[model samples]
Target: MTEINENALAKMREVVPESQIHYLTKAVSRDDKNKLGCEQKNGRNVSADGIFCGGYHPKSFHVAYWGHADLTARLLEADPEWNWEPLSVDDRGLPAFDQNGGLWMRLTVGGVTRLGYGDSQGKTGPNAIKEAIGDGLRNAAMRFGAGLELWSKSDLRSTQETDDAREWLVEAQAAADVPAIREIWQQARAAGADVDTLDKITILAQERMEGGA
Candidate 1:
């Protein structure tokens, strides 16, 4: 087996920052008659005031993701010469799709190449092609540990917990008085918030005070 460099792998696996993260809502029917039925909507499309208007549907849930641009940025940051190519092309020189309408591709970064496959998820036309390419990139990037957190069950649970704590912290920061903020901080600390959460609480409190809020 070929050995991967520890430092290189570490750099590739670095946790993606929250600012670059995006969320999409996905829903699946729970009824036995339609268990396989599903739908997906982009984050913007499902926002509180977006087309869906009332926010996510009862059966839908959000999933964290990095957009194609964000993934490309990460690849470039990890390996400036990173590149990818379709596994096959048609007579017209366009990328060819498989029997299932999925595309197969290879992604190479830092001299390591890996195969990945993607599909349009029932979509058709130019947008479907773009979506396939983006999905393929993300699938291949996973082999190199890029954006792995979004794919990890344990990490997802931890992230959810952190999100809950952050929500409380944010509410505290938005309180009308310093004392109210301090009280929330006490509750958060007593709940065994992590170091990062504690630090955030302190920083938010400082910002609130500095702004006379």
Candidate 2:
């Protein structure tokens, strides 16, 4: 196997820029017959226009996602020759689906390759294939840390917790020096700061040190 270049790997793992982030709305039926959950009036049903999935009805929630085009662009930006292919092809030389009706594929970037699987979620025909390809690409890209943060539960902190983390982040960023920033980071960690918060603290410390703050 070819070794992955450290610089290229780092670039591939860099947090995706906010501008490339997008939101998707998913709906869950409140009816008891729905497989997602039992019927309950936990809160009011709401609706919103989804970026790729179209409008959603009440009982729907929004989630952050990176679209297929964005993921592809990022891959190309990280590795000019990045590529992907299905694990197996059918008699007609087309991508083959597994018994579960899902597609398995491999994504290669910076000399690293990983496996990912995707399903159409009941969709069929050409659209199903497209959706599976897109989903599989996202899954494989995640192994390389592309858009990984959005998938992390650490990014799902409650509003109050997020507010507190941001407040700590402001303090860390405003520290007089690297030592002060380190001290703040320690405090935040002891206070049970999430992964995202700790990452920001570490990044700020590195910036300060690099600039001789």
Name the best candidate (by lDDT): 2
In order, what lDDT does every prediction score?
0.71, 0.74
Model 2 spans > 4 angstroms off? 1-3, 27-59, 154-213
Query: Which ranges in model 1 have alpha carbons more than 4 Å from their true place?
Result: 1-9, 27-59, 154-213
TM values, all candidates: 0.55, 0.58
Q: Please write out the lDDT profile of model 1 over residues 70-142, one tens digit for every residue.
A: 8888888877877899999999998999988899999987777899888889899999999999999998998
Question: What is the clash tally of candidate 1?
Answer: 0
- CA shift of 88, model 1, Å: 1.3
Global Cα lDDT for candidate 2: 0.74
Cα deviation of 175, candidate 2, in Å: 54
Model 1 gets an lDDT of: 0.71
Clashes of each: 0, 1
Which TM-score value belongs to model 1?
A: 0.55
